[model samples]
Target: MDLQTFMKDRKKLVEDALFSYMNAVKAPEVLLESMNYSLKAGGKRLRPLLVLATLKSFGKSEELGMPVACAVEMIHTYSLVHDDLPSMDDDDFRRGKPTNHKVFGEAMAILAGDALLTHSFEVMEDLLNYDVKPIKVVTLMKELAKAAGPTGMVGGQVADMEGEGAQLSLQDLEYIHRNKTGKLLGYSIVAGAILGDATEEQISKLEQFADHLGLAFQIRDDILDIEGDAAKIGKPVGSDTLNEKVTYPSLLTMNGAKEKLEYHIKEAKRILEEIPLESDLLGQLCDLIAKRDH
Candidate 1:
């Protein structure tokens, strides 16, 4: 398949699925609108695409993974809504539009994020309709919780907040990136494998691949903040610098960060090859992570 066309098509599927889920939920009018605002904000839809692509790599049908894919995107979008709050990244813009708080006010934005986060679990339950095994549903829910909960993304967010303006060690930086950014991504990849009933060996390899891919993804984001076109990126360059946050580029010099990104990308691809599945789609995703402009 043409990788770009494949990605675009899957992205559209995720977007449509997300919109439908949000629309079906009954909520206060403004709250629903606020949630939809950020949910509708255009992104690369990378997380959900990872779910679909990983499932495809194992010869599993996308239909079985669609709910999981859309649910992850909900969780991800909620994170972004909170991440852009005045108390958090405090950014004025996201995806080229005003941040949720800017458009919806801080309280509404917080509620919107809360609604989305909780609603994701509800969406995940939709898998039951497809004759998915209860055990698999439980596993998927557990994976989602572990990836987004205190020991996962929230812990990393806290570490990141505390590390601002402090001189963070390379180890400390990786800790932040691995949990803050990497865990959910790792979950996305592994969840697909689980849904596909991939062998233990294949799941193990994908986990390693995800770990490398997650780090590479964050490092690339840091690089883009320093050197990417602001218009294309949909946010000003140097936001991390402006916030005094320690990032890959901040801890490692530009060249050092680039080298690290390259290493992770290479490692991720190597792990995929070791899995020895039909991995062209997944390999292309690795390349996209390494080289995405936005």
Candidate 2:
């Protein structure tokens, strides 16, 4: 499967699934509006793409990818919504629009994040109805919970908020970011492996690729924050520096960050090359990661 097409198509799939799921909610008007506002915010939908494309590489149907894709994006979007809260990163805008907390009240934003986070599991239940083993579903859910909950995204967020303005050591920074940002990316690929019925070896290879690419993506994000076009990135330029957050670009020169990105891209490709049926689209996805503007 083409990575670009997978990303584009899977994103649309997730959007449709999200809308379909939203239709079932019997919440109050104010809560529903707040949830919609956060859910509809523009994003790259990278997590969902990772889940779908990885499954596609294994010749899995788009049907299996749909629920997992939607769930991953829901978890991701929830993270962003909370990240922009006044008590957290305190940003005014997200994906070029007012943040959930800004448009709705902070309380509602919190509730929205909570709802999306838990609703992801409900979405998954609706997705896998046949042919899949119950043990496999339970395993994947355990993995997702670890990656999205306190041991993963939330734990990372804790460090992020605490580390602000503090000059962190290299190890400290890596630990925070690897968990905060990288874990979800890691989870996306892992979900595909588990759901697609990949071998243990195949799962390991995909995990390695996702882990490296996730960090590389975050490094590129740091670079973009310093030098990216705000119009394209949709975030304030130099926001990292402004927040006194420790990042790759802050620790290394522009050329050094570029070198690190190159290093990871090579590593991602190298892993894929070792796996059977690893097509050109997988490599292209790494290339896209290396060259993404936003």
Candidate 3:
């Protein structure tokens, strides 16, 4: 199938399922509103889409991966919620609307973030229960915990906030992005690999692809900060520059960052090519990000 059609058909269902699960939480009403606000906010849904796409390519039913996909999105949304807080990026706007902390108080926003983070693990654990064996669920838990913990996404966040305006080195940028963004993206694919029962080699290949994919996403985000429209991006276009943040575009020229994005995209596709679990439509998905105007 063509990649656009494939993605269009699947993204809808993945998002629908994700939102429905969040809706069904039926937790305390106000807390649920805070959690659902950011969860339902507009995004490309790239993380969950990756989870579903990887699982699809590996012959797993999308339903089998739906819980994990929802979990990935929840973790992703949780990050965005915290990232916009006063103690963090301190942005008031996200996805063209007020951020969580802007709508709810900082404390409520913090609680919402905590709730989303904790609930994501619950969703993942439930997904693993669908697997054939106890060992499979245990393995899934291991992968999710590692990706979400201090060793991965959370570690990257701490470094990024603390390192801001510190004149970081190139290695520092890589370290932060690799963990903060890349690790969770890596777990999306790894989660798919485990659920789909991919071979060890395929899992490794997908993990590598995910790392490159995550870097590309971050680099493009940097580029967007430089060249993107404020209205489309839903925040100040020059905020990165305003913050004097160290980014690929700030360190190198815009053209140089573009080159790096292409390099990683090619690297990702090359890794995908070597894997027996090729999606045939993966290139379009990569290109979707690489060429996205918004």
Candidate 4:
């Protein structure tokens, strides 16, 4: 299938899996709603789609990696919910609607983030009931934990909080984006490779590709904050400037930031070419990240 058709089809698949899995939560109604609110908030299912695309590139069925896709997305949604709390970025809107903390009370929003984080494991555990090996399931859990825990996304959040009102170098900024966003993106690619039983060399190439892709993704986000439309982006622009957060555009001029973004995309595509697999979708995704207006 073509790239657009492939993404459209896989998006539906991921959405169905997310809704089905989330709706199965047996918790209190309000908390469940808060959790579901962000899950259904309609951001691009980029991480999950990466999982599926990597699986497909390695000649594995997307269904085999569906559980991992759902698990990663839940972790991502939980992070977004927590990141929007009053003590955090203090955003009142997400995906063009009220944030979880805005619609639900702050307490419920906290619980909802907690619930999503915890329940992602339950969703992952269901893999054991399928045809997957016990060792593979264990490896997946380890990967997810390391990426979302103190050593990864949470650690990045702490660094981000501390960096506010402080002058940060480009290296310091890269460190934050690499951990906060890149770790999960890398894991999604590696998850598909593991599921498809890719060779060690193949996994390494994909990991390198993911690293560059993640950096490019963040740089584009910085650019969008300056040049993008709120309607397309689904949030008011200039938030980074408003919050006094250091960003690529703030340090590098807009032209310089675009140059950096192009460099990353070029490096990512070069690494992708060395992967020795069908990665048209991954290639298209790289272009999308560099050019996305939102």
* Steric clashes per prediction: 0, 0, 0, 0
Candidate 4 accuracy as lDDT: 0.90
Give a tens-digit lDDT track for model 3, residues 103-131: 98999999999999888877766664565
**Which candidate, 1 or 2, has the higher TM-score?**
1
RMSD of 4: 1.1
Give the CA lDDT, 0 to 100, for residue 6 in model 3.
70
- Sum up the clashes in candidate 4: 0
Residue clash pairs of candidate 3: none
lDDT of 2 by residue, 102-123 (tens): 8888999999989988888987
Best by lDDT: 4
Task: Point out the higher-scoring one by lDDT: 1 or 3.
Answer: 1
Error of 3 at 236 (Å): 2.4
lDDT of 3: 0.83
Candidate 2, lDDT over the whole model: 0.83
lDDT against the true structure, per candidate, is: 0.90, 0.83, 0.83, 0.90
Off by over 4 Å in 2: none
Q: Write the per-residue lDDT of candidate 1 for residues 1-294, one digit (tens) a residue.
A: 666888888888888888988889988999999999998896888889889888888888887888988888888999999999988888898888899999989999999999889999999999999888999999999989999989899899999889889999999999998989899999999999998889889999999999999999999999999999999898889988887888888778999999999999999998888886765898888888888998
